[model samples]
Target: MIAEPEPGTTAEPEPEPDPEPGTVRPGGRTARVRTAVLRVAGDVLAEQGFAQLDLADVARRAGVGKTTVYRRWGSVTGLVADLLGDMAEQSLPRTETGSVLGDLRANAALVCRTLADPRQGALFRAVIAAAACDARTAEALRRFYEVRVAEWAPCVEQGVARGELPVGTDAGEVVRAVSAPLYYALLTSGVAPDAAAGERAAAAAVAAARGGVFVG
Candidate 1:
């Protein structure tokens, strides 16, 4: 027979319970793996550009199995598309200030901050370059902008509802107008927009909206 522990000794602690399957908890192993892979992908895109992106290199950097990477994302374009989707999902929600101008300014400021970030700026540049040559990348890029615009368009709609802007103002167009100059500055002059530029862009959109320029 096995001997019992001493009277004064404590018994070993029981093992922790396992979580239910098909129920993904945040910060779990699966989430960690995804986080690691995406981080490595972003790093590579920022440092080497899209031209140098390879699944093998990404798997090596992520410390994940090549098979896993291939199974999860079949091709380079697929990986990039998933990355954009993740970015859209994780992006901050639109701010709802009392006034449409305030909301637009908040949106403009968010765009300016993202474009001014070093890694983000480089990543976007790489993606844009890739999009110029790859149809899949172009479509993914288009979807990303569409998501962002849809998120902010409600603010313009609210402006019209509140009588701040003319009736029938095109919400999507106004939202796009606020971001157009900022992106233009980045793509053309290679200048990341500053807070002042963001404010100017917001103000210009508001002016145009009030002038019924975006009326449908």
Candidate 2:
């Protein structure tokens, strides 16, 4: 038989579940909550930009309690940070195409496709806009790129190992180079880069890598 609690003493409540990403913990209910909340948050950001993001609104759309959102995320910046972290965790892994040029082409194609995606492109613009004036959001955006760059950097390193790329090439720089022009065009001209642009970006980066511009 289990012993009863002493008089005037209270039993401990169940522990809260963990968050999906970032600083939050993860568990059954917690994961579900995070999924719902982040979905709504992304929708809001994509639809109305960061200016329209509100914890109460997200909670309403997510069917979660406002208190829960506030208590868990603390602020809009916190939610965005966690959302970016989740995105990084969920992003596709790098491709290995045996050749540096082929691998970079694959990478560039992925970036172009993402930028061409209406919802994804809008979400990225919103996040980038928020980062312009928000230090926390800016930091989170940097971290997101860091995670993505690290994921693909190994492809460049493998190319160097195979003698396809120059020795001492900066793998991260090469990886970023493949995507930079695509992002720049999208942000500057509001143009969704096509497959041709992807190919061009990859070719340019490969040429630069061969020319040892990425060497460090």
Model 2 clash pairs are 18-25, 18-26, 19-24, 19-25, 19-26
lDDT of 2: 0.89
lDDT of 2 at 163: 94
Q: Which stretches of candidate 1 lie over 4 Å from their true place?
A: 1-25
TM-score of 2: 0.89
lDDT of each: 0.87, 0.89
Model 1 residue 139 CA deviation in Å: 1.2
For residues 1-216, could you state the per-residue lDDT of candidate 1 as single tens digits? 112245787432232243465576787756665677788888899899998999988877887666666776788998898788889888999999989999999999999999999999889988998999999999999999999999999999898999999999999999999999998899998879999999999999999999999997
If scored against the real structure, what TM-score would every candidate get?
0.86, 0.89
Off by over 4 Å in 2: 1-27
Per-residue error for 116 in candidate 1, Å, reads 0.6
Per-model C-alpha RMSD: 9.3, 6.6
